[model samples]
Target: MKKKGIFVISLDLELIWGVFDKVDYKEKSSYFKNTREVIPEILDLFSEYNIECTWATVGMLFNSTWEEWKSNFPENFPEYQNEGLSAYAYGESIMSPETEFYCFAKEIIEKINATPSQEIGTHTYSHYYCLEPGQDLQSFEVDLKKSIEMARAMNIELKSLVFPRNQFNSEYLKVCKKLGIENVRSNPTDWFWQDTQKDSLKDKIFRTGDAYLGPINKSYSISSLKAEKDKPLAQKASRLLRPYSNNKILNKLKIDRIKSEMTYAARNEEIYHLWWHPHNFGSNPQENLKDLQVLLEHYKRCHKEFGFQSLNMDGVNKQFQNILRN
Candidate 1:
């Protein structure tokens, strides 16, 4: 029998919290509104395709109201040198909205919980930036502990983590291990994908072009998905599924590149991990969802013809542990 290729999809499910430091949420209200509406449709498509996925959610999003959110904060907070990076500060600055749709997402989370084959993982309590200056490992630990605690309130055990901003701090792995987190998503080994406080303009340019042109191998062998004992297994992500663009030629090129990479993984029995923020689909939602359906359809074909299997972050980690046992 041939080995099966693995496909993993993770969504960084941070609402406004993910981008408040960089973008003006009030100006992009329509964008966030579209995100709120499109989430269920994304879930529906996942159900239709029997796709398994992980939602690495920001811990504060578990709260339904601003009061609840305030109540759930960790004892210690990340005091980034740049105060703008602090979600706590941002949260306090904004007047509590009548409709807490943007910041709080307990309702959407429940929808995820109700969905089958969907795993809820932590994206840190306040979306803490591990690599950023002025934040220590101790602070990261408390944030992570708070994340696990909040998930438990909803009867969910968070065994997987996706670092906020793809920071992928190796030193923070100890904190994850201490908290019993079994898996984490790591950045690709390529130079352009290096985890850093900020990427150089040259690196950013290459990453953007690479999405449309095929110069990188975005797949990994099963044997490569391993971790040192007592550490959370690091599963490197292959690609970020960029949001739909208006340029038809550019959009086609990007999707084709992803499809080609998926095919290579299937034939080689390797791993292909695709991730994106739910809000990326906010602006061009219908077109984005349509493109997503195309990729899922491609996955279905690969499943039938080449034994490609879809698994969430935790599911992939379990297989890694099983290999260790054997």
Candidate 2:
């Protein structure tokens, strides 16, 4: 029997928490509300099909924020500090501890955990940019340790990590290994200075869905000068042209690319790591989720027709480790 391509869906899992820290509550709520409505639908589809996925959650989201909110506002908040909804509801107050955003995140994590086929992993404590020269490696290690510790507090055994901004620092890998992380997702493409280490490794690096499946042969023109506050006429025209040029065509190209990559992986019996942020679906989540559903359905059909088995990070690592030992 021919080996099937390994299908791995890695969700960044830090949607609102990551973005909310930067953007105001109003805009964040709007974005998260859209995301919340879309994700559960996708999760339902994945569950129905028995598709396995890995959610690398931000550690702070799991415990600290709730605790901090509760500690700060005890009387108003009745639930546990960390308790929040899995999906943010529409028109939620940004200041309230009872905001639907936290609740939604919690619910999703619980669902992911309850789903037998799904796997949960850690992204980091702060999802901090350790690649910047200013950030010391020791601090990065401590932050990662804290992330794992947070997961442990929740009784989640952290196994895998996805570097923030796809900015991977080699020293960070050592921290991951020390923390008992089995695998770390590294970029497969060449980067100038940020993830330059990725270029050196041939097969050790794991590629994600966006890298392999995002739009191809799409030309985008942007204003050379940073427009002040107003949207320039030329910029608006370019923006209008971008969708017609790249949206559907790029999506199709990405799907085709993923199909080809899967086929190649199947032939070689190599691991094909397909990852993407759950929030990538934020803009047009339904469409992106549908794209994901189509890919997963293809994977399921291939698994049944061939001998392919879907493996999470742990399974992938064990297989690779077994191969290494032999």
- TM-score per prediction, in order, is 0.97, 0.71
Report model 2's TM-score to 2 decimal places.
0.71
Weakest 10 consecutive residues of candidate 2 by summed lDDT: 234-243
Model 1, runs deviating above 4 Å: none
Best by TM-score: 1
lDDT of 1 by residue, 156-268 (tens): 99989999999989988977988989999999887888845687898888889989986647899878876787789899999999999999999999999999999889888
Per-residue lDDT tens digits for candidate 2, residues 191-227, read 3323442333432232223334333322111112122
Model 2's C-alpha root-mean-square deviation from the true structure amounts to 12.9
* C-alpha lDDT score of every prediction, in listed order: 0.90, 0.56
